[model samples]
Target: MIKTIIFDFGDVFINLDKPATLRELSQLGDFQFNNSIQDLNNQYEVGKITTEEFIRSYHNLLPQATEQQLIEAWNAILLDFPKYRLDFVKHLAATGDYKLILLSNTNELHINWIKQHISFYEEFKSCFDSFYLSHEIQYRKPNSDIFEFVLQEHQIQPTETLFVDDTKENTDAAQKLGVHIWNNNPKADDVIDLFTSKSDLF
Candidate 1:
């Protein structure tokens, strides 16, 4: 009896090399990604800081790295968005069988890169009934409040919503609120097999 579906945008849709950013940064001249930088990233993702401020922080940490270089390294994690996944989502949207939502924990630079690189980005975005980007919403996942906000905003029952994410941490947080979850492994699973992979829910 699922009436709403919530999807994560990163690995669930666009392919990502999770280690690419770190690898790129390490090569950018003595940039040690310590807990401080991770905190800064968390802050940036939640819209707590501006892009300039983010870059400035990085610049402060690695003085030798230019702004352009830092920005490039930051965006290295993003990869291509497969056409088949877009087709599947477009078909799903056309059915209009359930409310479709996209909930992602993303920052400004990554999104900007996608906008420039992914030709069908706008078309893909149009498929969702509601799209919640972390920086835009000022809320990121792995926290119950964000899920609560979504549930309340849409007036949807947690028991009737299905949240699909590539991260176990995010899915676990959603499941605590009584939502159905598919913690997909991007390496072994493609989102197009949603129904077959979790058929019991359907």
Candidate 2:
């Protein structure tokens, strides 16, 4: 009875080195991933700050790092979008069996980089019935509002919807709202195995 699938963009589809950003930033002189930076990132993810403001704020914090360097480090977390994953989703979309939606907590810089680097980005996007980016939507995962928004926007029954996210916090949040979930482990889990992996739901 699962009529809809909500997918997380990072890790679930694209490869991300979650710690890579901080690892790259540590190369900059005396840089620390502190609470202020974390708060700034959260704000940026929800579109509270513009990309220029985000870079400028980081540059202010780490005076030793140039804006371009900061941008490069920030984008280090994004690695690659595999062709097979794109093919899988595209095939799924072609069947029109379920409502496909993409929900990701990402920022402008990250998406801009994908558009530039991932040649099939547009094709990948077309696979989804609705694409919701945290920054663009002014909401983020692991929060009730974003989940509620998606559910209400689509008029999808929680019992008939499955949310797949690499982050447990996000899946847990959706689960609380009665949605079925797959807390996928990116290392061992491939989204293309959706039917076999979560066969009980389908």
Candidate 3:
């Protein structure tokens, strides 16, 4: 029986435009901004660099742009966290039918942004039995090791844990570990709809 649900924060709970930062950076530079932005993102995820360092690297690259402008542009990807999702997740937690866990691949700046902007961040997080952030864990998803780490830490049977993520690759990785998963595409289907549809199973 599935006794736990693992959720990916960005795109799943909190909406994020994965490419918005790079798109904004593209507007600031003359050359193609694709590869460099990706490299910076990878470095940030792997804990090889800090958010300040990442922002400064980009700012230095685009000397014409002010630091505040670059920061705002980078943060634009984190748009809004809807109240409905929080209420839904809270409902799931309130039922006491399953253990809730949040596993997200994020860094300091994004976290600080959420803490400042989302009024319910603390309450929403409190609903979870465990909250794992990649930066704090020093590991990110789509990496099998991180998935294995969570399974071991929680003592959760892979088959009894459902992993929901917005990215196919991440979900696929978890699925390989024998965990049930849902690839939640925000544009195609909201997570609320998925939860509602799967209510009978729960």
Candidate 4:
């Protein structure tokens, strides 16, 4: 039986404009986002570098951009958390039917922005039995080790868990480790479709 539910935060619950930062940064100056920047992002998400250093890395590239401007552009990717999703998750958590866990590859700036804007963040967070944010955990998804860490830490069986993520790469990684996953398309499917979509497993 599926006893645990692992969820990815962005696009799954919270909305994100993944390209918003690139657009905002372009407006500031000639900022090129290539493979190197993606590496820095991976490092930043896992708390390998400090927030100041993360911004400075961008600042170093686009020296013309001020710290405030860089910070604004960096945070543009994070959008709002909707109310209905919160309600749905809360109801699921209240049922005590399964162990709910949140696993997200998120950085400090995005999280801070959400806290500042979303008043009910704490309440929504409380619904999860285990909340794992990449920055705090020092590990990010699409890496097998991170998935192993969560499974080992919680003594969760991969076969009995359902991992929901909007990103295919992330889901693919988890599936390799024996976890059943729903590579949920944010455009067509919502996390609220949990029981109905994966009814057999439930």
lDDT against the true structure, per candidate, is 0.95, 0.95, 0.86, 0.93
Tell me the number of clashing residue pairs for each predicted model: 0, 0, 0, 0
Quote the positional error of residue 136 for candidate 2 in Å.
0.4
How far residue 125's Cα lies from its native spot in candidate 3, in Å, is 1.0
lDDT of 3 by residue, 1-202 (tens): 7898999999988888878886786777753566877778778877889878987888778888878877777787998999999998888889999998999988878888899999999999999999999888888989999999989998989988888898999999998999988888888877778667556446
TM-score against native, each model: 0.99, 0.99, 0.91, 0.98
Candidate 2 residue pairs that clash: none
- Model 2, poorest ten-residue lDDT window? 28-37
CA displacement after TM-score superposition, residue 103 of candidate 1 (Å): 0.2
Cα shift from native, residue 176, model 4 (Å): 0.8
Q: Provide the global lDDT of candidate 3 against the true structure.
A: 0.86
Give the residue spans of candidate 2 off by over 4 A. Answer: none
Q: Give a tens-digit lDDT track for model 4, residues 11-81.
A: 99999899998999999988788999999999999999999999889989999999999999889898878
What residue pairs clash in candidate 4, if any at all?
none
